[model samples]
Target: MKRIVITGTSRGIGFEMVQLFAQQDCEILALSRNPKPVQELNLSNVTALPFDLASTKDLENVESFLKENWSSVDILINNAGKLVNKPFTEITAEELFSVYQTNAVGTFQLTQKVVPMMKSDGHVVSISTMGGVQGSLKFPGLSAYSSSKAAIITLTELLAEEYKESGPSFNVLALGAVKTEMLAEAFPGYEPPTTAREMASYIANFAQTGAQFYNGKLLQVSNSTP
Candidate 1:
């Protein structure tokens, strides 16, 4: 069975991804700030790990876990993220840093630790937002969140190139609006065309197959056809 590591598995798309992977017989290290939800699933293949992407201390724990328990990872999904909805001018430095810490900095830190543990043909997938892409949709209140996700896109691209010869493939999934709590918080009263389950299913399938054909690419997944 494939060994998979995924972040933000407490809820939303992350939670759904864990379920899908577990159903497919993968051994999953599911990380979340609160692991109770994952633990409650009680699946033998799912190992719920408590983690807070914003916390460097928690990152240390993640590194330690990988070193002690696993020699190699087949798939790594950097799916945890933070969102801040505020006007550009009103966005505080702390708010921007918080979003960046979770979406970019923390993701990079965790990936660096896991990269060495990844198999030669391993796949690394990062979850970014469609708004992060240049010339994509622009929203008034997503300045910090969008910019942070943009950083993830750039990071993934650079890592893919840097590690091209070394082995593991890197890719970014630039997802459109999904009916997640994060989306509801950012766009109150608006219904998203896509649901978290739909996105998670796509991501789980892509995680298993996309690495064969895609690397260093930003894949845009949306409800509407481009």
Candidate 2:
């Protein structure tokens, strides 16, 4: 059975991902600051933990769990994100730092912990936003969120080059408007064509086999226009 680790599991896409992965014959670690929702699911193959991507202690706990439970991880899905939908001028320095801390720095740090436990066949998938893509139609109040997410795009490419010889391919997905909590936060009352579960389902499938055919690439998973 494949062993996987997924972050931001309290709700939306991450929550759906945990459920879908649970249906498969694999071991999963589902993490979020509020782990109660996933814990309530009581899936036998899933383990829920209270995790804060910005917290060093929490990051270490994730590493500890992997070390104690599995020899190696097959997939690491960096799905946790933070949104700061405010005018660039109104976004305080601390607010910008927090956004980056959760979306960018945390992802980079977490990968440092998981990559060591992965083989060449392993896959590391990170979720980004179309807003993070340069020239993808910018929004009014997503400066912090989008820019921080953009960092992952470059990081993925650099990692793929660094580890190309050792294995464990790295790729990122730049998603468009999906009916997710984050999307609602960014564009309130706006409806999206895709649902959270639909995106999560696609991500799950990609995490399993995309590495075989791709590395250091960003796939734009959006059917809707900005």
Best by lDDT: 2
lDDT of 2 by residue, 1-226 (tens): 9999999999999999999999998899998999999999989999999999889999899899899988999999999999989988999999999999999999999999999999989999999999999879888899999999999999999999999999899999999999988898999999999999999999999999999899999999999865
Instruction: Rate residue 35 of model 1 by lDDT.
Output: 100
Q: At residue 48, give the lDDT of candidate 2.
A: 96
Off by over 4 Å in 1: 224-226
Off by over 4 Å in 2: none
| lDDT of every predicted structure (CA atoms) | 0.90, 0.94
Residue pairs clashing in model 2 are 120-168
Residue by residue across 164-196, what tens digits does model 1's lDDT show? 998799999999889999988888888888889
Best by TM-score: 2
Clashes of each: 0, 1
